[model samples]
Target: MRMHTRIVPLAMTTALLAGGTAAMATGAAGAAEPKGDVTAQSCYGSARNYTGTPGGPGRNAHWPATGTYAYATRNCTDINLKVNYTRDVRVCFKNTGQCNGWKKAKKGVWKVAASNVRDGAGFYIQFKGANRSTGKIAY
Candidate 1:
């Protein structure tokens, strides 16, 4: 009957569409890696957040200047920082057990721990030495 004929074409079309959609999703999952600046904001939003530059040759983590709390202008070239507090935060890195207070820090890459920042305080890279606070960043 006419109804049966129409049903077959509709069913075939639906099946084909579904198959194509599934294939496309699978392909997307295996696409190229992500690029650009990486950022992590607080649950309450930008009030407390951090951003880092893309990894490359001799490139270290850098923070923005102003807008938010805290500041630092240092490129962490060969070190990683795990910050558990903000504004005089305690830092721990490779080869160093207890780094000096934020004020007397050095220029290098830091991987700030979001959950570690205390009491809703914002994260900021601390640039040490003479030219302190080249910049700061907020997520």
Candidate 2:
């Protein structure tokens, strides 16, 4: 009788553990998608608003200056850039060697900048000239 009781309890415990693990897996699979907008300003105080689907592509206003920049709101999974003038631009993870290529800027459109970036990486803009540009940025 003693051995029987011990085995029943052990089996019950195993079942409970298996159930808990399955629940955890389901929760992770249904994890919520990112929401809301992220905005970043230029070194010269130009506001670039990313008003797109959270964790998706979007647009912004004109920005000026050339330097490394990041969003102040939340972490992003990827990033891209576009401009109103012809120039070279790239986005990079802050403080890391991971970066996109120096693609030529498109006029008032969105272009692929970087992918698989660190969750909260910054960007590097290479303004060939003019020092100012307007367009969209996906994040």
Candidate 3:
């Protein structure tokens, strides 16, 4: 009998790396609605608000039900987040359950509407511990 070694796929490896990237950030999300995906501020603001249905177009949509995003609370987990632009390239908490309300982001394609500042700003660390916006931005 011949023994075979199992090797993890490159895609899987990339995913693992991505999940471990959030903790390495050096900024925070703002409040009052994120202005953009790549802002100069950190997401240490109203990221939790991203999960609630505040009733509006700036909300995080609905997650898996009306979208694809889930819910979690990593506080600095790692995952594949992005500056979605389903409407205008918004900054979502791509951690894990971050942007589940919408579909998975496509390569070079925008998925989120736009960084409402008070709306965006959250994290999802690999489908675990997802956090929403905190509404701490000073716009």
Candidate 4:
């Protein structure tokens, strides 16, 4: 009876230790992975009213008022946009004159504006129609 009690406790302790070690290993592995898959390096642009008119000839069709540039904090492959209201918006690379097609983004939803964007690239929000806009940019 004494031997049986001692063996049972020893086995339980070993099993508990092994389970804990496995859990720790899993946590470590997860920590090493990329934090965000779609928006790895996200930068937020505060919500603000965009008071601008539609673009005309000689001016970009999607212009007038633009949001601040959200620069990539880490290397990323795509440029994403999100807004608080359903509006027509596009992402333009700073100083590159490269812009993506205007996409109608739903409120609080993420929309991919451009892909193959390099790290540290700066991008800003352009509106096709004027309205209050707010959201984030990530790659």
Cα displacement (Å) at residue 106, model 2 = 1.6
Candidates in order, TM-scores: namely 0.32, 0.42, 0.17, 0.53
**TM-score-best of 3 and 4:** 4
lDDT of 1 by residue, 30-122 (tens): 574334332332221233334433223443233434333442222221223423232233233223233435432333424442323333333
What residue pairs clash in candidate 1, if any at all?
49-139, 50-139, 64-136, 73-134, 75-108, 76-108, 76-109
For model 4, residues 3-40, the per-residue Cα lDDT tens digits are 99999999999999999999999999998787665344
Ordered by lDDT, highest first, the candidates read 4, 2, 1, 3
Task: List the lowest-lDDT window of 10 residues for candidate 1.
Answer: 71-80
Best by TM-score: 4
Q: Compute the lDDT of residue 44 as modeled in candidate 4.
A: 29
Q: Give the Å error, residue 4, model 4.
A: 8.5
Model 1 lDDT on a 0 to 1 scale: 0.39
Candidate 3 worst ten-residue window by lDDT: 125-134
- Model 2 scores a C-alpha lDDT of 0.52
Better of 2 and 4 by lDDT: 4
Candidate 2: 10-residue stretch with minimal lDDT = 52-61
Candidate 2, residue 122: Cα displacement in angstroms equals 2.8
The lDDT values for all models are 0.39, 0.52, 0.33, 0.62
Ranking according to TM-score, highest score first:
4, 2, 1, 3
